[model samples]
Target: MEFPPLPLFTEVELKSEIARVATFKKVPKGETLIRQGQYLKVLPIVVSGAIRVFQTFEDREILLYYVRANETCIMSLTACLFNNESASYAITDAPTQVLYIPSDYITDWQTRYPSWNKFILAAYRNRYDELLHEFTDAVFKKMDERVLDYLRNYRDTHSVHTIPISHQALALELGTTRVVISRILKSFELEGLIGLHRGSITLKKPF
Candidate 1:
């Protein structure tokens, strides 16, 4: 099947540029799309399924966020666009398919194709908008509200109300300590607001 068209490239554009692009399928669960601390050589667009962006601490891996179908994953675009080394990881959390465009393709497009250059600008603009939203939310929203927002945005639809995330993972994402998270989660459990398990938390109601 033809990949669904994203605003980055229209049908005509993709058809004309097919020779420079490639597609890859990735199986679910624990697949690393791009390793941490390595150079990012390709810009990837999710064709299907989902992927998680994360970073590893001394014995823990903290999830930053996820990218679903139709979204693009370029965590360190500033560095990648400048051909600098990458400092973050992009890994697939679900079975996924992606369209990969080589790094040089961007330079070639900027020099040879103005239309494609506009598309690249649009892509960067979208990423910038997302980052701004996150920053604004972080500054203005309460911790509990931010946790709820994260749950709403990232929860698994197949089952469970709360997102499948560890306490430490949530702590790192929220920029807090695990002890603080544990206290909040315990209060949630006591209030019948949520249920906690070994690796996940389940929202009870109004989630």
Candidate 2:
């Protein structure tokens, strides 16, 4: 299949320039896309499937954000622009297709391509929007509410109600402990909000 068309290039430019500049990769689920502290020589543009970017602490990890179809990771761009290494890990959540454009092209294309400059600014805008959303949830939303939001978004995105994840996994995703998440889950079950099964959580009502 043709790679997803990027707005970074006009149709005529895409046909000649962008296609020539990008290298493509197909990856399977669970594949590591970028490792923490790894050198970034290219900018990853996800054309299909999902990638999870997460930060690792001494004994825990928290999801930083997700990049999926039509989206790019701002940190990846930052690393390339600043000559810094990737500070977080990125892994494929499902079979994925990515377009890797060489880092050198970032600066060069900005002056050479109007769309590239727009896309660069847009990436920062998107990152700010995402950070604000996360901050709002952290400061204003309750843990149970955040859990529900996460599950709801996951279900809508993946088109599934049965989420195959452990309590520990949920805890990590929400930046909390397993014990606390387990307790909240139990409460959800008692309240007819969810159903908990081994290695999974099922929504009992529309969220």
- Score residue 77 of candidate 1 by CA lDDT: 54
Evaluate model 1: give its TM-score: 0.78
lDDT of each: 0.71, 0.87
RMSD for each of the candidates: 3.2, 1.7
* Native-to-model Cα distance after best TM-score fit, residue 114 in candidate 2, in Å: 2.4
Expressed as tens digits, the lDDT of each residue in 34-118 for candidate 1 is 8777787777767778777877889666665667676666565544688776666887776788777777676777766666666
TM-score of each: 0.78, 0.93
Clash pairs detected, candidate 1:
none
Model 1 poorest ten-residue lDDT run: 1-10
Q: Identify the candidate with maximal lDDT.
A: 2
lDDT of 2 by residue, 105-151 (tens): 88887887777777778878987999999999999999989988999
